[model samples]
Every structure is written in structure tokens, then in C-alpha cells.
Target: MSKKKLLVYGSIILSMLFWSFSFVWVKIVYLIYNPITTVLLRLIISSILLFIIGKGIKKLQPIKKKDRMQLLLLAFFEPFLYFMGESFGLQLVSSTLGAVIVSTIPLFSPIAAYIFYREKIGIMGLVGILISILGVSVIIFNKNLNLIASPTGIALMFLAVAAAVGYSVVLKNMAAKYNPITLISYQNLLGIALFLPWFFLFDFHDFIYAKPNIKVWIALLELAIFASSLAFILFTYGINHIGITKTNIFINAIPVFTAIFAYFVLDEILTFQKMAGIFIVICGLFLSQAKLNFFRK
Candidate 1:
């Protein structure tokens, strides 16, 4: 790969790692706060930090009046619905299962692209999607073939997946008009606006009375700085450099990274089945991008 390609790929991986760690961080935050409070505070802090950064660099360009609707839609799908689904979903299911389901975003993202942009998927890519699904199934099921997660939890995680696909599709178009920092900052602000009412309605008392310790505060800072802000900037940059389909393929790594993090931090078991599943998921990720001699002239 050239230097530019390497940078793009590196940024994608960094975004994946930041997002992977967020699974752990979310669990940590829930120790003291509810989902509404967690998501609200995350967006609030990230929006403020991004505002300060944008002002420091004098890159705070106002959104075009015509583009405001599209920006709102982006926020609606992402920090709004996406976090709502993922956070509440985590409460219902194991983080491992949630990560596995969210990793399927690449599968649906390409379909969304094809629906909206008429992009075509090659045979290899479809095969890769199937293999990755099998891998995720292995991770989620035991020898008895029973799913460890509830159906409601699975549905909520899929909601997150769908919202993520929408976010990526909209984000690709928006990148033409805005840089990554401005887009993320503005979308986060819009997300805060949308979540404020819900937060106050549901989590206001929880927020006021919750006694968060130093550890929870660190997790909140990590979410605002690394996961919410920097990860989003890197993800948006990747979507701009590559298309949504290619950018989303990296999501398969999230489950792998999250599993590892859980093993070390939460003392979750890294069983043989999960290890094999992680290996297969990695293989599927590479296969999804492989172009064989069948494409030669």
C-alpha cells in the first residue's frame, strides 16, 4: 500500500479499536448512570470538546441552509438512534453478542449503498458476508445450538446496525460539503439537542443522585474524547477516502477487539469456540476485499 492508503487503513483500525473499547466503557458507565444519562453526557462532553477544538483552529464553518436537513438526518440515525439501540441493547444482552451483531453493519451497508447509489457487490463480497455471518454465529452459539442472548436484545442490536448503515450512507454524501471534524461536531450537537428532552424526562433524577467515582469519570472522559470524537473523525475520514462498503468491512474487527478487551478487563472467558470464531471473522474480513484472477481481462 502507498502512504496515503496506509494512513486511511490505519485510521480505520484506530477507529475500530476506539469503538471496541467503548463497549467496555459503556458497561462501566452503566454502573452509575442509565442509558439516557450515559448517552446524553457523552454527546454533551464531546460536542463541547469539539467546539473548543474547532474554535481553536478557526474551522467552525456554518452549515449551508440546504444541507441542514441532511445533517439532522445523520444525527438522527447515529448518536441518537444508534447509541440508544446499542446502550439499551447492552443492558439486555451480553456485550459479546451485541458486538457480534453490530459487526454485521458491513453486510447491510453494502445493500444500503446498492439501494441508494446503485453500487454493485461482487460475488466474492457476498461470499465473504456469508462466511462472516457463520463466524458470528459460532461466537454467539454454544455446542447445544442455543443462543445465549434474548430475541429482544438481538433485535435492538440489529436496529443499531441499520442505523449505522444509514449513518454511513448519509455521511459519505456529507463529507463532500464538510470536513470530518466539522461534520462530527455538528452532528454531535444536533444529537445533544435531540437527546436533551429524553434525558431530562427519564434520567434527570438518576443523573442528579448518581455518585460516580473516579473510575466512572475516567470512562466518561474516554468516551467523549476517544470514542465519540476522535473515533468518529477517523471513521468519517475513512468513509470519505474509501466508500461506505469498504469502510464498513473494518467493523468485523470490533467483535474481535471487544472480546479481547472483555477477556482482560471484565474477566470474560475466551473459550475455544470464541477463539475459532474470531479467527474466522478475520479471515472473512480479508476475503471481503479480495479480488481474484476472475476479474482479470
Candidate 2:
């Protein structure tokens, strides 16, 4: 692979890693903060940090008047609706389970991508997605093949998956026009605006009364800086370089990363089945990215 290809893959993988860590971080934040409060504060902090860094580096692009509505819609699908589902869902599910559910974004994103951009996945890509989803199923299901997670949590996480699919469709239209930093900075800013009323109405009092210690505060910061800010920026870069279908397929790796993190941080058990599933997930990721010409050769 060339340097550019390497960079795109690196950025996407790093974004997945950051997002996987987010599941763990949000769990820590939930020990004291409510979902609304956590997401609101996360957006606020990320927006501020992104703007400061973007401006200091002179990389922030001005939003064109024509694109304002599109950007707002993008933010609505993502940091607004997406966080609402993910934050609440994580409250009721294990971090690994939550990540696994969110990782299903690839399964749904292709339809949206094709409808919006005429982006089509080849045979290899389709097979890879199926294999990876099967791997995800292996990780989530018990030996009896029954899912034991909360139904509400599963539904909420699927809500996040839908929001993410919408976000990618909108993002595909915008990524070519904006740099990652500018896009994510504006995204978080708009997300904050969208979430503000809900925050005040539901979680304001809780936010005031919540006394988070150093550890919780640190986790919140990590969520804001790495997951909210940097992950979105990197993901935007991936979408700009590769189409949405390919970019989203990387999401399957989140479960693997989350499982490892959950084991260490949250003391979640990592069974042999989960490890085998992780290996399968990695194989599927590689298969999705492999060039068909190589297979023919």
C-alpha cells in the first residue's frame, strides 16, 4: 500500500479504537452523571477544544451558507441522536455488548450509501460484512445461541446504529468539501445546540448535584477529547478518502477493542468464545479490504 492508503487505514482504525474506548469511558461517567448530562458536557468540551486547536492551526474552514442546513442535519443524526441512544444504551448494557451492537453499523450503512451515492459493495465486501456480523453474533450470544442482553438496551443501541447510518449518508455529501477538523468542530458545536434544551429540561439539576471525582472527570475528558473530537475527525478523513461503505466496515473492530478494554477496565470476563469471535472479526475486516484482483491472481 502507498502512504495515502496507509494513512486512511490508520485513521479509520484509530477512530475505531477511540470509539471502543468511549464505551468504557461512558460507563465510568455514568457512575455519577446521567446520559443527558454526560453527552452535553462531552459535546461542549469537544467543541471548545476542536475550535481552539483548529483555529490555532489555521485548518478550520468557514462553513458556507449553502451548506449550513446540511451540516445541521449531519449533527442531528450523529452527536445528537447517536449519543442519545448510545449513552442511554450503555447505561443498561455491558460495554462490550454495547460496542458489539454499535458495530452493526456496517450491515445497515451499505443500503444508505447505495441509495444516496450509488456506492455498491462487491462480492468480497458483502461476504466480509456477513462474516463479520456472524463474528459479532458469536461474541454476543451464549453457547445456547440465545442473547442475554437487555432488550431495551439492544433497541437503544440499534437506534444509535440507525443514526450512524444517517450520519454517514450526510457526511458523504459534505466530507469532500470540508477538512476533518472543521467538519467535526462544527458538528460538535451544532450538536451542543441541538442537545441544549434537552439537557436543561432533563439533566440540569442532576448536573449541578453530581460531584464527580478525579477519575470520573478524567474519563469524561477522555471521552470528549479522544472519542468525541478526534474520532469524528479521523472518521471524516476516512469517509473523504474511501466511500461510506468501506469506512463503516471498520466499525466491526469496535467490539474486539471494547472487549479487551472492558476486560481490563471494567473487570468484564473475556471468555474463549469471545476471543475466537474477535479473531473472526479481524479476518473479516481483512477480507473486506482485500483487492479482488489479488484473489484472482
Instruction: Provide the TM-score for each candidate, comma-separated.
Output: 0.93, 0.89
RMSD of each: 2.5, 3.4
- Cα lDDT for residue 83, candidate 2: 90
Candidate 2 at residue 167, lDDT?
A: 92
Per-residue alpha-carbon lDDT of model 2 for 1-297, expressed as tens digits? 999999999999999999999999999999999998999899999999998999899999989999999999999999999998998898888898788778768766765766666665556656777887787677767889888677788789989989999998889889989999998999999999898999899999888888999999999999999999989989999989887768877887788889989999999998888788777766766666554432221
Native-to-model Cα distance after best TM-score fit, residue 262 in candidate 2, in Å? 0.6
What tens-digit string does per-residue lDDT give for candidate 1 at 1-297? Answer: 899999999999999999999988988999999998998888889999999999999877889999999999999998999998999999887666678788878777766776788776566767777887888778767789998667787788889988998998898889978988999999999999999999889999878999999999999999989999999999989988987878888888898889889888878787888788777766776676665422222
Top-scoring candidate (TM-score): 1
Q: Spell out the clash pairs found in candidate 1.
A: none
Per-model lDDT: 0.86, 0.85
